[model samples]
Target: MQKPEIQQLLDKSFSDFTTFIGSLSDHRFIVSPEGKWSAGQQLDHLIRSAKPVNKALSMPRFFLRWFGKPAKASRSFEEIRDVYRDRLQHGAVSTRPYIPPVTEIGQRETLLKQFDQQKSKMIGLVGNWDEPELDRYQLPHPLLGKLTTREVLYFTIYHNYHHLHTLQLREKPEQPWPTQLERVIF
Candidate 1:
């Protein structure tokens, strides 16, 4: 709900995702079966999603204020998550820029390292703002229209799990990856 809490969620989710993928072999990570995203592509998409937030957070406060109005009322994390879930159910898909490449051979380490960097930047960025600042600034959301900074952080937390759930759903029953989802912390 607040910056520290949001930062913790952001950090833990990225760590959890990295740990999950780190346990998988290169072949399993890169191979997209039955037209679904491969484990590697899932990581790529996560990185893509986080990168923009880092950029947005780096902008001047004046610019952010000038561009968007303060939210009339803050939406709870569940409300934002449900909107995204509903959109996914109705056939919404990520835009082309946010979609990851299917193949990036021998790039897992690089991708994971970059992911950590983005995560650290995000945590630091949010740490500089208080709750009112978070509630006052708004960010554009593709599906939900507009969301406050706090709402965006909340969505990032849920977005990681949403992808993880989809990835787990695509896993074979016999595969160990499917079982890890049971222990998801977020």
Candidate 2:
């Protein structure tokens, strides 16, 4: 039973995340800004982001209670990347080896569809559960120590918005910048 407020947050986050991903045209996907990683890399990164959310969903209540939430349970900066890699069915998308595998507009559309579908699974996994999404009831983070399952939810959604902001900037670099960016400031 997800609380209404949190559920609203999750729903809005999902909507926003998809919108960000969808905005990228096939041409934009290939644009990595400075030959670093094109929008393609970022979009793939966003979809790959869902893998760990599902992995955490699969953990047993006992394991979660014992482990609490891992510091980087939501997104990979470095800490959780390997865990996410090991769990990936086909391995995480590599930013290197720069293969421009001619994925079509239809293919990109399918990927976005898959992203939303997988995200639905994630929402189902964490919804209204007595058990924590993280391995332990509480865990330590570099900035915020000793956070609970609920806090993990907040962290996860905010993390989504964090990247969305970056993606939005890529979408619109000319604008001076909106006074208020997408919601999720809390």
- TM-score for all models, in order of appearance: 0.89, 0.59
In model 1, the clashing pairs are none
lDDT of 1 by residue, 5-42 (tens): 79899988877777878877777788765667888888
Cα lDDT, all candidates: 0.81, 0.54
The C-alpha local distance difference test score for the whole of candidate 2 amounts to 0.54
- Model 2, backbone clash pairs (residues 3+ apart or across chains), number: 8
Deviation (Å) of 149 in candidate 1: 0.3
Q: Which tens-of-lDDT digit does each residue in 43-88 have in candidate 2?
A: 4555665565566556666665665445543332233423333544
List candidate 1 stretches off by more than 4 Å.
173-186
